[model samples]
Target: MIELSFAGWFQCRLATDPDPYDEPRGVSGYVHAYAGEPDLDRIVSFQPPPFRRTHGRDIGVAVDAVAHEGIAVPDHPLVGATVDLLDAPKFEGRNGVVADDGLEPLYPFHLQVARDDFRAARAVVPADPSFPYAELFAGGVEFGAAEIRKATGEQDLTATWAARVTALRAELADAAEPLRTAIAERLAFLTGNLGADGGGAARFFGALMRYDYVLSSEPEIDDPHGWLDATDHDEPWRASFWLGGWDADVLCGYARGTLRLPDGAGPRRSPRVPRVTDRRP
Candidate 1:
């Protein structure tokens, strides 16, 4: 599996197809999860970080899960963490192409960590056994230039490279302290991106993230997703944190407060946020 590093800052917006009429537009509003924080001063030197534009399947899945499970969104804010997709399955369809349906593309995609995996998300059991096994979300990890330094074969673990890795780890450790705290205080963390507004377990998860984006007027969302008019401010409403070993503990701690299964078991063992090797090689 190829691993890419993503900084924990991005914008939440409606995923629109550049060609609105000709292509299938994504159904869901989504955040543009970027490789690094958008820097103004670095704009001239900034290479646009490699990013995965959602075809809207992730948001659609979240909406379906919330509706199906009868989940509820909390009145307060919730932190939304991006899952580690190192081992996620790359979705592919026949012809490796998409059909033009005016909605998001439905074929030849990869979705390593989809919103449907959250605890609050329940698969819609179809009356007909074969409903085409459709998955709304697609697209896998998009690698950036940083990956060129990845070591391989006997050339791996050069002294200088090891030093750089050690330094980067140290820097990340230092920078993550405030980011973790700020994230915890600013929003409620989720095992995955499902949100809702109900009681008990439902109170903890829902489609709230999308709710915030749709309500923000700073960058009004187009109406493909049936989003309401602006009702909230647009100042860092949500972000996607890369929870690798360097910051998993901090991120997980923030999420643990409300992230639990219906049986009252801890969420770590749950499929939404499984424990795995978080270290970078």
Candidate 2:
């Protein structure tokens, strides 16, 4: 006597007993792909006594039945039936979530099934391009160091740093209005704190390049300072100060109409001016 179980998101059952179990079984293994459909009636016919019954079946049901039989059921209507166990894809850490494909960096949700299973299943396309992270960065606001590396052999650190700064400046010049101003101000603050001489700029730029890639990709990210903490730098307070200045400049830009708001986002309220505190000696 062979016992089989079919388990997944879809509901299904195959049992030799006349009265099949009411509850669905828990998913035990990763999803798999099979060559052909299972013949429920033929499979039930093979079983002794009460005979098996299939209810709300899926591909998993056929795979489970084939595994139990231990031999191919060639005579059944569905021919060349075979189960092909699929391998899982590689997942890398992005933002705070683990994802396989290069989806929106800020999308925190993920779904995984075997390759073969996915190919056989229906493909669902998202209606909006910025789903999952749409509400977070609706304005498409993105900033951080731009790519300024040249693969022209090895060069002196000072020369390399100068070239990078020049490239960054050129990129900023092409940016739209106040966004350019916001980025330029932030970059100046960062470089000034790190210092231009004594390899400080080079060290900071290296860290900035890596960190900025992650930051720019994740448009929905809320805490810029938090992400900047991942950079390889001893003075984390620099990042905090830089982010504060960047946010202030961006908000002011929006208020001044130099920067445009996201679609459907109403006009921004005027930024509150800080009151000067009087101190007497």
Candidate 3:
């Protein structure tokens, strides 16, 4: 078993075929472990493993061999964290890969930490001072414009729509305390991705409204997941917004009026909002 000790973060990526004609020959994905302090800037600079003909298959095997025992991180909050690979539901037609009688093959695999450890890891990693918006939102702005053009058959109207988005942001500012901050953070997450578009943002905003309505009407209820489910969004989308690390707890805190923004921490404009041209379609 190979043991790794580090203070940085872990990310997982699925292995892809180097040759279209040949079958996949080994374990499914790679667990990229970086060695550094948990600071984002420093951790992002660590080099990833070089590409290999086997797609890091041997690395995958080494990880899987110790899955039951789990990887140990000495002196870290996530010490004794259990490590495991994401599993597929069933084997498809990939040759040379065998699925146990009832188990699925680990195709398109990547590393996943147990829920408790994941929360702990995220908790210690200092929140990016920017909180929600980051460089990634620039890409989202372009993708959003393209999506708008596709749906409305209109010429690129991102400038006009961006104005509307700005108006929405301004309106949200007057919303009651704590809830205002919560909504801002949630909106940032919803709109901070390449897949984000105006429609999705609108829908998510509506869902947030509905969530507020539920909490107001039924003050005794403590179920954020149930309220999200009633909003009619897909499970994965809901999970991404509500269950990703501390989001659910944060939402519940807002509902219970227990969440408080630290002094000097609340919604603030990004230093610069990149122009649509700043990102390619």
Maximum-TM-score candidate: 2
Tens digits of per-residue lDDT for model 1, 1-281: 01111222121222222322212222221222123322111110001123222211111111111111234433211123232212121211222233222112122111121222321111212122333223222222222112222211112212322343344444444556644443332233122222333221222111111000001113322333222222122221221221111111011101001111122222322122122221111
Worst 10 residues of 3 by lDDT: 237-246
Select the stronger candidate by lDDT from 1 and 3.
Answer: 3
Q: Write the candidate numbers in order of decreasing TM-score.
A: 2, 1, 3
Worst 10 residues of 2 by lDDT: 249-258
Q: What is the lDDT of candidate 2?
A: 0.23
Ranking 1 against 3 by TM-score, winner: 1
- The deviation in Å at residue 170 for candidate 1 is 21
**Model 2, residue pairs in steric clash:** none
Question: Model 2, 1-281: lDDT tens per residue?
Answer: 11111111111122111222111221221111111222222111111112211111122212222111234333322122221212211111222232212221212211111222121111112224443232111111233223212211223434533454566577777777555664465456335634646554233222211101111111221222231222222111100001100111011000000011122223434422223111111
Please report how far candidate 3 places residue 185 from its true position, in Å: 56
Where is model 3 more than 4 Å wrong at Cα? 1-18, 21-76, 88-111, 115-281
TM-score of 3: 0.16
TM-score per prediction, in order, is: 0.17, 0.18, 0.16
- Candidate 3 per-residue lDDT, tens place, 55-173, comes to 11122111111111244424433333333323221122122232111121212222232324132101111113333112112121112333333322434222333543465477676
Model 1: worst 10 consecutive residues (lDDT sum): 207-216
